[model samples]
Target: TNLLGNAIKFTDRGSVRILLHLEHGGGAPLYRIDVIDSGIGIAADKLGSIFEAFVQADTSVTRRFGGTGLGLSISRRFARALGGDIVVSSVPGQGSTFAIGVACGPLDGVAMLNPGQVLEAETARLAATEQAHWQFPAGQRVLVVDDGPENRELIRLVLEECGVAVDQAENGKVGMDMALAGDHGIVLMDMQMPVMDGYMATRLLRSQGYARPILALTAHAMKGFEQQVAEAGCSGYLTKPVDIDRLLAAVADALGGRLASNADRAAATPQAAPVAAPTPIPTPALALAPAPALVPAPGPAPHAALPPLVSRLANRPRLHSSIRKFTSRLASQLDAMDTAWQAGDLAELAALAHWLKGAAGTVGYDAFTEPSAELEEHIAEADSAAITASLQALRGLQARIVEPESPADQLNDIKAST
Candidate 1:
């Protein structure tokens, strides 16, 4: 944690990453955890004593970066106590790498995570089990239309894991073209974007006689927005920062009849929420003799307690590579927003905000999501004060958007594309 914290604090540009690998030595298996940072690097001269208490590369680094410098000393002592050592390498201006080597427990018992874990977790939270409930049958596909790369990627990842193939389009015009050009179980459409928006796209698709379900994805949840989208010919409406379950449920519902035609798979429709119906209680007035002391019935075993909120993307192996790609581009995504905002391109800014709002939340960056949504809303409302405040909040999160490389990656620097 200390190493990661330091890396992020000094890395104003580029990235911070964690790398891990198994090292086979003379007797034991050693695990190496490397925290790499593209930050102001330490000089060769200071590398020797830099781990000492209250020490840094120089006074200037201390003043500029603001640290009391106890983190490394404490970390090293802990590492040494565990029969491991923390080490560092650096190029004065480019970056630095800090690695700690430690022994691990036996690996013979290690197993890949089970998919049942997802069911237990999801069922505990949503009170809905049966993983097969949302799993589409063979040859099933859904068309996902959104201008945001992250949004499209997230939906694609989640759907693909459920046996549903996906086709993607970036904006309404392209989405409209694709919708007409192909056959799909359903179309998930983002209601706002450049070069055209979802409402127009759906309208055009409908006018042209394309009749498959088109589910509207929008951030706007105002009083009459549902009716507005319905009038646009959307089969269903879902608000943004799209909940994984809701998206799955809506798509499954849209694919209802289609599921029946494919491979003997049942079309699973979610039951109406139980809250919608009131359970009646019989008056106890006539219950004499304490209801005859009835014994409790043995029902199903209790489910595991609901775990911490996990992203819909979590628990799937397919998500790893996509997250790496998203993380690598995070800096430039922020850059795009700044440029759009400076140019007073409200449409462009709103599109960017819309993407950030959905993508960040989808990717487990909860803090980044709400502000992104606020910025989008303010831009739409043309409220200068709210927009500026939201922009500032988003700018603060930019510093925190540093990508922590997955422990499974070898800690390679993800070079930003030129």
Candidate 2:
């Protein structure tokens, strides 16, 4: 019931049914309780191990459906502790049934709600509360340093959407210089950039006695990067492509006086030298903007008066033109994502899709956000039926961004040009 209850929480349009079978013998009555669901079923090979301690069927499964793998393991343990064993039968596309057998006990007063009703209520309450809180601060300054145009733009879009003024640096050297010159409240520093990477930049900042919070942004490859990020002199670390809620929370934490700890630093270890540049993973059907590409062509410029919000976007001496340039670059990335989807290279399509979901919502592309989110969900599911449906919806969204209200027959004219 516990495991079934959680599955219902994550799954929509799934039926949860419990089957109870009783075997009466001369000695005692044995009871078998089975909980079945039409939701996403566990893979066959994984079904056996899911009940093992500390093991998850897949990491993304955990991310998409949040849980500690301990639930089933604990449930089995409790069942065994009470002189029964639990078993499972599942086929990935079909459904799953978890059967628990035990010695029958006395009748008791146990209350259960209609699963549909409870789940709906919980979902509604959570959605309502989420809509109401809306706690991000307005117009805070944020500096983003990343080598990839996609990454840079994604962060820029996110912060900008929350009404935070944003600035960008393509590499560590530039970001470091910007950090030294600007009066930013926070720095979102990416780990692997040309000229200077996040670690070197962080070390430099700390050496120069820079006290502002710097958050290292990297793909959390393993547990080690967490510690490496901290040791590199960052106050915190966020994994990419960043989750919007997590990113906002980290930003709020840094801004609201949450300080990094030595333990956090010790936990993030440096990644092993790479044999090859990690190929950009396709984001799951999310809308992605291109990474930020800053202008200036490595030349010196005279200082100009920046808006108060822009001034705080960096420690840089002047930021008047940079802010506008950065936002413009972000807009371009959104166009790029739209283009990728039309071309239909699944890899680029998925990457841009995932990026846009996070980027669009963060940057306040109000119309595109929810559809982008739905696109990501369908892409992650990746079933043939779901993907086809999602693809159509995505094309519709692309039309909205690039070609609203054009005649349906002429849609291809506005489709991405690969």
Candidate 3:
């Protein structure tokens, strides 16, 4: 799929072809699939490196064609996992072809059924079963505490459609107050915030005998972050750019009193067993509501103004309502960052950079990810000049983000060209 998809993506003027056939060797069947594209072909020297993770043919290729450069690497791994391998051949100005070969073993009882059909059926069954575990009981309410208004609004919109009442707080202090005063069935707490961080807030709530389930919401999907949240007394953790299905499912599991222990939460990965759902409670008066259509807001004017939010959710009305507030908050953070740098306050600068990096990506300012990362490295090395230079570059990128096209549009254009 990856090879074919890539072929289609790069071949703007010509055709992409797929050829599949079976061959026999040593009295055993072998299947071969070839994807060929008349696209901007790979340079001979770069062909091998393209299959390596995060190594595109060239930096210019990556800039012109957006990808993390991991698709082919992962696809090769998958082919190898299936007891096969993928090989590539290309010419600099002509085209490229990828071939995959897999062993075809004898089928036993299920010989009558097509393998693809059987796989699809089993996948659908598992999806249905997983979704069933995310159905919540009646009258459940969830609290979302995040400094970013857009983040909170997005969560609220998703949960409300799932028949869950959502209340918001701008920071952990307000969140702590609400958690103590209100009877929330579960809490989605942001780990990083201006007033009292989520870790401290969670600790306070735990110490004050607030027993409801708490799930940490964070953009830092690093090694120790989940364990940190678990140690702070959270039931589970969800990383941002939050997936709507996963968010609702986590809440449902928490509301159903199926929270995982700290140890389990710390070690858990996506492939781990899902939390068990409790017996269904009586159905409440509320019913599932259809989500509204997303329409993009007016683009921001050019120049020193903060860039408009450019996420997958940019067109969502609920998220649009919080855009100004989100941008304003980001602007203030940048100003504070400047102050911290001038004052040689490395600690403050690092903290602000960390917060800005997380919040910027959450609100869809993906251009900031790299510069923010660079700023963090500069701060760690105590390189003031490099930090200043990176900050200026970030501001320039933010200012130039006027009316940038959404990734969805780019994808559609690629499909049309193919």
Select the stronger candidate by TM-score from 1 and 2. 1
Better of 1 and 3 by TM-score: 3
Among all candidates shown, the one with the greatest TM-score: 3
Error of 3 at 284 (Å): 57
Poorest 10 consecutive residues by lDDT, candidate 1: 284-293
Task: In model 3, state the lDDT of residue 382.
Answer: 77
Ranking by TM-score: 3, 1, 2
The C-alpha lDDT values of all candidates are: 0.70, 0.59, 0.70
TM-scores of the candidates in the order shown: 0.52, 0.43, 0.54
256-334 per-residue lDDT for model 3 (tens digits): 7232233433333223222333222232111112222223235554233333536554655445544445566776778
Model 2's alpha-carbon lDDT is 0.59
What lDDT score goes with residue 52 in model 1?
94
Clashes of each: 0, 28, 0
In model 3, the Cα lDDT at residue 140 comes to: 85
Candidate 2 residue runs with Cα over 4 Å from true position: 1-117, 133-139, 257-418
Q: Model 2 residue 390 lDDT?
A: 52
